[model samples]
Target: MRFEIIGNIINIETIAVGSSIREVERLRKTYGSGRWRKLKGTGTIQLDDGTICEAELHWYEAHGIGKKEIKIKFILSE
Candidate 1:
C-alpha cells in the first residue's frame, strides 16, 4: 500500500490489490504514534466487486504542511 502524509492528513492513497486489513492496521500503528492521532472522519474503500465501501480510517499524523511521505505494503491472501 502507498501511504502519503499530505499536510496534516495521512493519506493511504494506493493500497495494492490483495493487501490485508492487518497491513493497513500495522501502517496505522506505525504512523499513529507520537504527535499523530487517527483522523476520525468519512472515507471510502473500493472493493474488488466494484462496490465502494464507505468507512472511517483511523490513521493520521500531526505534522506541518507538506510533510514527508510514508509508504508501506504487505502481501495479501488470494
Candidate 2:
C-alpha cells in the first residue's frame, strides 16, 4: 500500500492484499506527527475500477505558528 498525505489529508493506495497492525503503527509513528497531524475523520477513495475504499486522514503538527503538513493512510477491513 502506498500512503500519500497532503495538508492534514491522507490518501492511501493499497496495491497488495494484506493487513498488519504493526504496519499501521509504523506509519503512525513515521508520519503521524512532528510535521503532520492526523485528521480526526474519514474519507472515501475511488480506485481505478470505481471501487471505493475508506481513507483515514493523518497530519503532522507544525513546529510553530505556521502551516502544517498532512499525511494519509488507508485502513483495510478485517
Candidate 3:
C-alpha cells in the first residue's frame, strides 16, 4: 500500500536492531550498510485515495541510508 506521511511520527520505538532484523542482509544489499534498525511509530498519513488516517508505521532505517520499505501496520478507525 502507498501513503504519504503528513507530519511528525510520535511514539517512536525500536522493534529490532542489527542481526535481529530478519531482512538485515537484504537491507544491506539493497540500501547499503549501517547500523540497521526496524522501528515503528504512530503518525498521520494520507492514503492513495486522498483519505487521511492515523496509523502505526513500520520501516527500516540506518545511520545514513534513511527510511526504507515503509508500511502501514495498523490503522486507527474513526
| Candidate lDDT values, in order | 0.36, 0.40, 0.93
Candidate 2: where are CA atoms >4 Å away?
1-40, 60-72, 76-78
lDDT of 3 by residue, 1-78 (tens): 788999999999999999999999999998898999999999999998999999999999999779999999999852
Clash pairs for candidate 1:
none
Write model 1 residue lDDT over 3-69, tens digit each, in one string. Answer: 3222332344423322333354554465542333333333444444554444434433444422223
Of candidates 2 and 1, the better by lDDT: 2
Candidate 1 vs 3: which has more lDDT: 3
lDDT of model 1 at residue 66? Answer: 20
Measured by TM-score, the strongest candidate is 3
Give one digit per residue, the lDDT tens place, for model 2 in 1-78. 343322333343332221322243454465453332233444554555555566664433333423234334545431
User: How do the predictions measure up, each by TM-score?
Assistant: 0.32, 0.28, 0.95
TM-score of 2: 0.28
Error of 1 at 59 (Å): 0.8
Rank order by lDDT, top first?
Answer: 3, 2, 1
**What lDDT is reached at residue 47 by model 3?**
91
Q: CA lDDT of 56 in candidate 2? A: 65
The Cα error of candidate 1 at residue 72, in Å, is: 16
Name model 1 segments beyond 4 Å from true: 1-34, 64-78
lDDT of 1: 0.36
